[model samples]
Target: MIRYGILSTASIVGRFIAGIKESQAGEVYAIASRTVAKAKEAALQYDIKNYYGSYEELYEDENIDVIYIPTVNGLHYRDCQNALLHHKHVIVEKPFTLTSIEAQKLFDLAKQNQCFLMEAQKCVFLPTTLQLKKLIEQNVIGDIRYIELKAGFPGRFDYDHWMYDLSMGGGALYGSATYTIELMQFLFDNPHFQIDGSCIKCPTGSDEICNFQLKMNHQILVSSTIAMNVPLKNEAVFYGDKGYIVIPNYWKSNHLDIYFHNGETKHYDFPYQSEFVYEINHIHECLKQQLLTSPIMTPARTMEATHLVETLYQKWQEDTNE
Candidate 1:
């Protein structure tokens, strides 16, 4: 079994660790945190056998075959680089890095080291998400038109938490919009067409929310938004000449309703799990094929989607400063 090492005591890592523990081909063997107390506490809570006080120690551990880096956004680049340098496969949390350049560097290092690397953008692996992609490919909705997406929830940002700090890469656009952007990338396939967008920032000068309108090369237009200081609402609406598809709570959605101009309407529901077992299983399949990353979540696509977000933020920053 592949041994997994977790890089932080971050809450999201708990779900990922659970997924790893449940995977038949992998095990949650170790975890590291800046503080030994935190690492030991997380290890005990998650039943992890090995714990390290420093990330370097965990990366240096030869027994660990893979590292799951769920640290804050800004740390992803450095953490991933270190893990790859140690010759360990790595799965990093979304917003892959502050910029596509950093992401490319990590991917390059992974290639040079002959190790695997992937962004842990989990929604694409959901059964509903997969089925939706299939339906779109099958042209069940006819030619695609405009798509609308929105996902947001009021965040409890701790003053001590890295998420509230701009330098630490704290922001709704980078933190949450990564999911929406990646989903669009998955549905539309590469290059993602053109996206013209704007954003709203938090009092701290971080992007607290964003709204975007984009068009795919296939002539599919999309409108999307993400907000952190708001109630939880996640939805996506896909419009086509002959019909439309609506997915409510799409980030981890399990149900999809499709409507057609021909007076036909259908709803689909897929089983749900707190953790993404299918995504992890797909990773195992990629490993078996000796692939560096899963095709569905390719690094290029991740970079493209992530680049869109970074570009939006840059534009917003420019406009605000002007």
Candidate 2:
């Protein structure tokens, strides 16, 4: 079994650990936190065998086959870089990096180190999402033309939470927007897209809302709206000449419906499982095959998503400055 080392004691770690326990390909062997007490506490709570006070110690361990990083947005690049330098495979949380440049550097480092690296984007690996992709490929919706996606929830986080700090790469655009942007790319099979839209920033200089339109090569139009200060119907709809496809709660959808212009509707319900299990198994398969990058969530695709986010933030900044 592949021995996994966790790089943080963040709340998301518990969810991931649950998935690891459900997976047969890997096991959570160690955990690291900023303090020994914190690490020990997390290890005990999770029933992990080893704990370390510093991330460096985890990296130094030769037994760890992969390092799972769930650090804050601003720290993703640095932590992944350190793990790669130590010749450890890395599975990092989404919004791989704050900028495309950082993402490029990390990919280069992973290549040089001969280590497998993947962005922990569970949506792309989901059974429903895979089924959706297959259906799109078969042209069940007939020549895609437009896509509408909206995902958000009310902002009720503590003032000091990292989500409210722009310096820490905290913003709705980098948070939930990662799912929206990547979903678009995955569905359309085009990472080369342009964005034209605006954003609303909170007093802390972080974006609370963003509305944008993405245009892909064949003139496919995608409208996306993400906000943290407001609640919206969270779904992704694909419109085509024949009909439309709807995936409610697209990020974690377990079912999808296809509608035809002939007034026919077909529904598909996939077996429900923790969203993390699929991606964890995918990573494990890649590691076994000695693959450096995942075919489904390639580094180039990650850079493209990051670049789009950067572009949106730039537009927000320019508008705010004026």
Candidate 3:
């Protein structure tokens, strides 16, 4: 069995730890936090065997085969690098890196170390998402034309919180916009997306909320929005020439509806869970196959998403400067 170590006490790790337990493909052997108290508390609460006060100590544990780095957005790059350097397969939380350059460098390091590395973008693993992909492949939607995705939650911004710090890469654009981008990638056969227009802001001059549009090489138009100081109502709509598809909760959708031009609609459902067991299961399968990255959530796709995010930020800045 693959023995996994989680490199955080971040709330996100709780879901992942539970997933590992549920899958039974791996065991949550260790959990680490900035403090010994937090680490031990989580270890006991979760029935994990080991706990570490610092990430380094957890990395040094010879028994750990994989480490889940679910830290905040900005820490992902450095944290992932450290985990890989220690010879552990690394799965870091998404908005994978602050910049595409950092992502590429991380990939190079993982390659040199011969360790698996992937950003934990879980939405792609949802059964509804898979079904959608299959439908598109089967030409159920005829020809794809436009996509609109919106994701946001009114986060209580605490200056002390990592999500509120720009240096920590805290922003709605980087943190939440990623869900939309990942969905777009999956729907469009991972097409080459180009940012055509955008409205973005660090309203507090520190963190950003962006509204952007992208143009695919094939003339498909995609619009997206990400915000933090807002209510949580997330959805994605895909419009094709012959039909349209609606994903209610794009990130963790269990059911999606497709509407054809003939006024007929069909619903698709997948196994339901509040956590991301599917992605974890996929990781287990990849490890068993000795694959460095998942075919579904490859490093190349991660870099592409990051690059698009970076491009959106640039356009946002330019708009603000004007």
Give me the candidate number with maximum lDDT. Answer: 2
Name the regions of candidate 1 deviating beyond 4 angstroms. Answer: 158-161
Q: For candidate 2, lDDT tens digit of each residue in 15-47?
A: 888878888778999999999999999999999
User: So what's the TM-score on candidate 3?
Assistant: 0.93
The positional error of residue 304 in candidate 1, measured at the CA in angstroms, is 1.1
- Of candidates 2 and 1, the better by TM-score: 2
lDDT rank order: 2, 1, 3
Give the total clashing residue pairs for model 2: 0
User: Candidate 2: where are CA atoms >4 Å away?
Assistant: none
Listed in order, each prediction's TM-score against the native is 0.94, 0.95, 0.93
For candidate 1, the lDDT comes to 0.83
Candidate 3 lDDT over residue span 237-321, tens digit each: 8888889999987898889999999999998777655458999999999999999888988888889888887886776667668
Question: In model 2, what lDDT does residue 311 have?
Answer: 86
Cα lDDT of all candidates, in order? 0.83, 0.88, 0.83
Please report, as a residue range, the 10-residue window in candidate 1 with the lowest summed lDDT.
Answer: 155-164
Question: Model 1: which residue pairs collide?
Answer: none
lDDT of 1 by residue, 1-322 (tens): 8888999999888788767766778998889999999999999998888999999999999899889888888988989998998999999988789888898888889999999899998888888888899999999998887888988767577545666676888877777777777887787666346878887776778767778877777477778887777764588898888899999988778799999999999999886555477788888888888898778899888788778877887888789889
